[model samples]
Target chain A: MNAVFQVNNLNKSFGGLTVANGISLSMEQGDRVALIGPNGAGKTTFINLVTGHMPPDSGSVALRGADITRLGPTARVRKGLVRSFQVTRLFSDMTPAEHVALAVLQRTGRSGRVFGNFGAMPDVMAEVSEGLKALGIDHIANHKVSEIAYGQQRLLEIALALALKPNVLLLDEPAAGVPQSDTSRIEEALAGLPDDLAVLMIDHDMDLVFRFARRVVVLAAGTIIFDGTPQDVAKDARVREAYLGNYANARSSV
Target chain B: MAIQRAIAAEGKVDAGPNWLLRDLMGLAAVLAVAGIGYLLFPNNLALLTRITAIALLVLSLDLVTGYCGIATLGHAALFGSGAYAAGIAAVHFDITDPFAMAAVGAVGGAAAGLLAGAIMLRGRGLAQLVLSIAIVYLFHETANKASNWTGGSDGLAGISPDPVFGIFGFDLWGRTAYVFGIAILAVVFVLLRLLVRSPFGMLCRGIREDPVRVSAMGASVNGTLLRMYAISGAVAGLGGALNAISTQVVGLDSLSFTTSAEALVMLVVGGTGSLFGALVGTLTFMWFEDFVSAINPFHWLTIIGALLIAVVLFAPNGLYGTATQLLHRVWNKR
Candidate 1:
């Protein structure tokens, strides 16, 4: 379990309200870790700081054992890190194929060429389709991003991130707002990623989290209350207290 | 990538069959009319030259507001700077050749664009717009103060754009002027057209749609935007240089807010996504401005304002895209 991302003594605040306070954790490559917490406990903020969405006030975020505390989101992705938004960020008018193609173009660095020469390139479209197929959304390649269902948009965004071939993928509430029927499929897909690819997710769905996460870091009040395997996290007294509801705690255990 | 490339390779826009043919024919017909107008209204050839020059400037606005998705109302600063560059060359160095002025103007405009891009790209949306507008005002102030070269209200005059081949001069009838401008327009339009259809073009569209996703995919939002801004400015500069040549005068009007607003309105009226839209917008705008002004000078404003409102309501995609969209819908309905 090589640590792919290591955060130490992290703190972030927006105009004096602390969003992430002194958070320290290490996520191994291929480790599915659910960062669970109440709605403003900085679950999203913490993930954002790690992915370079916003610079932290003070702390270090190391990827593959190298500190990237100051790297921007895009630069971090080049070092094998990628993230999807909490709200779906697909191009509403663009086809799904067009969405993935742009990602591939960025990674492959083919976008800068004069327009006259690029469409003739044979490999670009293949990569676009391959990415779509991997995410099981190739059937919707021609569909506009706006036309897709909420669940499919999530997968499409994931495919967009995957097109970059990042080593560490950040999924913020991968199952948030998704239908109950789609939860298991989403979970299985998350769990099926390459073992060497690291994933850290912020999901409120404890059942889905427990099923997919080998390790869990339960956040409360902008700090980690529990960091252990799913079973240990379920047994932690503080984790139970923080959830503060029988159904939630039971869902975590299951 | 391969399949998408295959889709793009055919240059088949879902806009439907014969669209390109229709577009090219339209281009040819419009150009031929102008070409014939050159021979017939040699007296108004100078005005036609002005139209060609404005087309290039409007095309630059198309790049920023259309392709890069940064709606700017301060682009006239770039146009003015370009005109000043050519003006200064004509006044100081006695360099009055249209090509030389174009070179200087493009460089000046590109420099302003690059600087503006760096300062504004990170600002995002409304910030970028406000910052750009501020920069234009700042430049306009500088131009006003530096009256020694720019001629203040009178503008830099007596600057003539020497005709190409040296054997000819800009005749009073504008025959030489028309030939010179038409040639430049042909090249600029073709190049911009090729650029907008390419992967670079697609990426710009992608950037406009979602810069966050674009950045995460490793496209440097700032860099792409910066280059785009500079390119747009250079085009504006070329237009300015050509304007200086055809009119044999440069005015403070080059930097006026009205210039920027009108070009933008023209872009919206014609459509942004298409270079043809830029050309169409510029032509329609100037044509209407001329026609309406001749009928009732004070009333032209109301007419133009109403036209803009109608465009927004009836064709939100603007003229070119809307027309194609409508055609597609009808075809599908059939």
Candidate 2:
């Protein structure tokens, strides 16, 4: 099977601090991969390099085998590469409906229309409604983002990414600041994503990583130390030494 | 069930009738105000016409600085370019038809917008603001140096536009000019209302809120802003063309730094990001300035400063913005 998303020899450094070091990764359609790492493991940096938010010092990124190493973040997104922020970055004054609607319009290249309201466009609104509903955020679609809960805002971020009709979705700590009670909603939303869409999630929650990921990739000090099934990840000596440590051993014992 | 709930939520927030009703009411209020001004200040139609022209300038300024969140203090560059273009067309090209002149002006303004957007959009915040200031000075100096065309500091005169459909002469009493200005303002206001509510407008609002996120959403931040800047230029140019027609003179003052600064001040006083606020601020500030200066010419600046301070302290959202917020609160209570 061909990989839908591919990264080759990605290398980045901020002066002496190397954020990404010769990283090569690929995912087939419908692959659920969790990127796990210790603090400053370059997880977010790797995502940034792939998404074209930051330039890689020496590497190439490709979506469906088409080279996009030099594309800007906006161009990358246009090519079906979409990402959500680690912290919920939402338009404070806009409602969830407006947020989703913008993504749909942008994805369809109808955002440049100088006349006509998005609300009046039945097709666009339908898609917006569907996207929000998928994430269980339809109830708060009309409420301003500032007025909504953090968990709902996080969900809206995912809904926004989904609205773009991404073939490969990169979620950066979607439930980072979400309360313990609100994490399940995020998990459900993650599970509800289209089965054929590839997802690479950067997360700290081990339970979420174990539950959502069929495959796990661990990064330590800017290098991929382990890449295999979740079942074998806990048993990898290097991953256990570098990141999982006792947690992996504890899970293995259970 | 989810789709039904979604539809119900949308209905509750923005029903078709509610939007239509609000637009109609807004249009009515603008016309009503125009009518009242016609009745109350018949002798001062020229002043009213001047107010109308400046109001357009402020409105255009709001599009870039307010809607796009681009900090620019030299928007008069667009306004002045429009005025000069219209003036030059009349003197050199013999395009004295008022509509034609307005078109010429709009084209000129848009071209200038493109130029300004290219330079200013390279940087943001304070850097953009400084670049804008530099741009206006450059335009002002260019107009000054090109004395043969722009009349140098003497100001360009002899802009006699053929009357509206060649029926109403631009009389000294300023009757036609005032009505013409109002009509144009009304049309632009309506079009801008549609524009601000459109998908492009939402994208701009998104850009304003967080440009990085908007870019992440696959919209080119610079491209969107440049388009808006050009649109803003067209609006301002239309106003300048009107000024050239009504007043029959295009001066270096049109492109002056003071003009740009005044437009910014008016926008702030009225509120940014709201079209109605632009009009309200322009009318209120100009009228107040006229009234206060007439009453106490020496101390008027002090009084205006006090008024600004008061508005900023009490209604930080500007007068119209605060009023609308209060109205919304009252509306929700009922």
Candidate 3:
């Protein structure tokens, strides 16, 4: 069976610094993987390379057995390879409803309609409501994104990614910058993601990572140092030296 | 649910049943204002007609710059192309019909837009601005060098448009021209109102704020922006044809750098995104210019400069945008 997402020897570099060095990874359907690394360990770079935001110097990224390395970011998204940014990238003046509505329209190929308003389309609105409600942000859907809290903004990002009905989701630090008090809300949203959808989340929070990931992949110096069950991830010697270090000991004890 | 209720309550949404009433009211408001202008400036109809044409140019600029965030200073390329196409059609091809000339102008403008959009959309921000400036110069030089068709720097002349539906003739008093210009403006204004409120408009708005995010949502940012540019070109072209038909002359000044810069200024002063703001800005700026220049021709430019500075400083969102914000606040307080 073809893996839902496969990356083969992905290589990228900026001048002398290599961001992705021969990174080979694959995920099966329903995989819930957490990608954790140090600040400069190229986690975000890997996501960028796979999602087609940045071109790979040498490698191939495939989804459902179809190679998509040459495709642009927009085309990759249309093929159901969607991602969320670490920093919440949203339309500030637009409402959450507008964002989700646009996503739904784009997904269904109706965003180019120059004559009709999305508000009048009952089917579109129904899906928008459902998506917002699923993220527990339906009540504030009508409010402008600028007026919403940062935590809610993060949730909106996830909501946007999910609206595409992606087969493989790459979430770049979904809970970053969100308050500790609001972290649970994000975790809840993460937990409630569709069961059969493959999710690859990059996060720094060990607790969230350990709780959410079925398998954890650790990267250090643009190379995958560990790829195993969360339990074994903390015990891996290379992972301890490169990333986990003292935290791995503490995490294993807990 | 509350979402449905909110959608319904939101005035900008739901372009279906309510749009007829809204559009009719908008049309009525525009005609009423035109009627007042006609009553007040019966003798200055030519000036009013010119304002109407420039207003259309500013409106088209708003679509790309204001809505899509594609900063351009070569919009006059599209406008001038329309004027030249209309003039050439009438003078050379014997297409004397005003409507047919407008159609030719629209096609001309759209072609310019496609060419300009392809080049401009390649680079963003300062690069995009520079490319637009370059394009306008190229177009200007091309127009100048093609003397036979464009009449060189002497300007394209001998453009005579047929009467509207074989009834109202293009007269010396500029009466028919002014009335025709207002009628066109009203119709275009109404259609644009619908265009900006549609899903496509929302997509452009999304692209304006965060194009990267829009792309992640599976939209081709350049493609969407290019399409908008073409539409903008068409509107500007229509205005150009109107000018050609009204004045029976097409000049090199229509394609000049100053025309593009002035259109940008008018759009900014009126406010960028709002169609109403475009009209308001054009009317306010042109009327103030005419009113002041007529009094003191030499110092008029300085006064206009001061007014622009004041508007940018106090009303950073442009006159219409700032006024609406204040009105909203006041209404909320009430």
Q: Please state every model's RMSD to the true fold in angstroms.
A: 3.8, 3.2, 3.0
| lDDT (tens digit, per residue) of candidate 3 on B1-334 | 5667666566344436676686787678778988999999999999999999888899999999989988889999999998999999999999999889989988888889989999999898999999999999999999999999999899999999999899989999898889888988898898888888777899999999999889989998888999998999888998898899998999988988999999999999989897888988999999999999999999999999999999999999999899989998999899
Q: Candidate 1, TM-score vs. the true structure?
A: 0.90
Chain B vs. true chain B: TM-score for each candidate? 0.90, 0.96, 0.96
Candidate 3, residues A76-188, lDDT tens digits: the string is 99999999998999999888888898999999999998887778789888888899999999888778899999999999999999999999999988999999999999999
Interface RMSD of 1: 4.0
Candidate 2 residue lDDT tens string, B148-183: 999999889999989899999899989999898899
lDDT of 3 at B274: 77
How does the DockQ of candidate 3 come out? 0.62
lDDT of 2 at B24: 78
Best candidate according to TM-score: 2
Docking class of 2: medium
By TM-score, the candidates rank as: 2, 3, 1
B29 in model 1: Cα distance from truth in Å?
A: 5.9
Per-residue error at B28 for model 1, in Å? 4.1
> lDDT tens string, model 1, A125-216?
67776777777877777777777888888888788888888878888887777788877767766866767778888888888888888888
Give candidate 3's TM-score.
0.96
Candidate 3 - CAPRI tier?
medium
Candidate 1, residues B1-334: lDDT per residue as tens digits? Answer: 4446444444343222334566567568657867786776666777788888888888899998888889887888888888888888988889877788878988878877787777767677798788878877788878888889888877888887776777678778777777777877777776777677666777788888888777878778777888888888898888888788777888888877778878888898899977878887887888788878889987898998888898889989888879989998999799
